[model samples]
Target: MAVSRETEPPAGAAELFGETWTQAQRYADLLSTWGVDRGMIGPREVPRLWDRHLLNCVVVTPRLPQGVTVADVGTGAGLPGLVWAIARPDIQMTLVEPLLRRVSFLEEVVADLGLENVVISRSRAEDQAGQFDVVTARAVAALDKLTTWCWPLVAPGGVLLAMKGRSAPEEVEAARPMLRRLGVSDVRIETYGDLAVPTTVVELTR
Candidate 1:
């Protein structure tokens, strides 16, 4: 990892989120800036970008395999994928979104950040193959559906760093049959409360 500063978020949040709210805020600002430019959101709603978007994405970052290549499936505004790319920069990332408008925003962000390790793909994750070490899905689907869409993209020994809610355990239980068939095991949960929307990181190793 490149040497990085310990820019912690607001006090309590640092405990839960591991970054200063300022960092999340900056991410929000960037997202909002793009949202406004694209007309995806009104200016007023931009202020809530941190609460509604950035924080939601950051909560899932900790679950990713450190320094591994990652793919963000259904990267609608490039949440954890874009944020993680900005945060780590050490990990190579592919941000896949089917929407052209969002892809335009992602392209702008990547260019603005000079992110050498990132690529914005205007395609479905399932449509691409053998290009990533880790796969990520944030609020993308029920575990069963998510696996069907994303698990195949992960290489053996890699994982799916998926986000889930409070009922994650049950989601995992419900996804067991599919998980087994997909050659995935070791479903683990990681919690983050610093986000305005609390989340659970549900990891499945392939």
Candidate 2:
């Protein structure tokens, strides 16, 4: 599945991505091809891989503090995990997925892209030890369950940046009790990217 020029970065991409724009394009192409064939992404998703996936994932980069250790939980095909690694070389990223197939694919992509800052962990978030400065997830689970799984991996004063949809606020409301019990000090909803297609993120600080 070759990437179409129409799906390439938008006009302001270079300004936002700088020299990494070309690398991001290559990553997009790889996702469209290997990502679909491996069943990590649907065939219909191929056409919008650049905007719907890669760009949407990279938009979260700005919210992260510099030089942090990041854990991407349930990283199916490495959404913001691999994408963030491509966008911000300063961060060390750990891609955590339980499925062997997805882990294999992530390992291959990491090797193929020569992403030294990224590591593949074939384990679920609950089984994984060690804390990270930032924990990221996309389409992983509901806010309540997600926090249960990911919160343990967040270091003291670290944060969990969950890429959510329009129901972010509602999820926060429903997860309020869990947040309080888990010692979450702060929570907020932030929107990023173009107005036409923004990415909603729920941030929880521990």
Candidate 3:
């Protein structure tokens, strides 16, 4: 089946991804073909895969501190996590996922791309031990619940980059009590990229 109306990478994709553009393209191909066949990605998402999925994730790579350990909680189909690993080989990326089917797809793509910077952990975020310099999630859960699961994985002086939608402010406000209880005072809403609707990230520092 045809993935999307726009199968080609959108304009500026190469420049944005820089040296890793080729790997990014290969990853996109996998997402369009095998990813869809395995039900990891919805058929409707194929058309806008480059713009909505790849670009949305890649745009936020600059925020990650250099050469730090990063974990992407519930990184289904490798959204920002795999994208970030492709773009920045400097950082160590751990794609934390619980589903077996998704894990299989991620392993295949990671090997096919020859991405040595990535590690696939087939476990839920809450069950995982150890901490990372930065922890992030996309469409995983609300801010409050996300904290409960992801916060423990964030090391001291680390940050949780929760990619949210237009309702980021509302989610942040609703999670205020939980945030304070967790001793999280440094919460900020930051926008990244020059897209029409920029990526909204709720940065919760630990």
| Leading candidate by lDDT | 3
TM-score of each: 0.79, 0.94, 0.97
- Give the Å shift of residue 175 in candidate 3: 0.3
- What is the overall TM-score of model 2 with all chains considered together? 0.94
Evaluated at residue 106, the lDDT of candidate 1 is 78
**Would you list the C-alpha lDDT of every candidate in the order shown?**
0.72, 0.88, 0.93
Report the C-alpha displacement of residue 17, candidate 3, in angstroms: 0.9
By TM-score: ranked, best first: 3, 2, 1
Model 2, which residues run further than 4 Å from truth? 1-7
Candidates in descending lDDT order:
3, 2, 1
Candidate 3 lDDT (Cα, 0 to 1): 0.93
What is the C-alpha lDDT profile of model 1 across 55-136, one tens digit per residue?
6666566666678889999877777787777666568999889889888887877776667888878888768766578888
Q: Tens-digit lDDT track for model 2 on 118-167? A: 98999999999899999999999999999999999999999999999999
| lDDT score, candidate 1, position 47 | 45
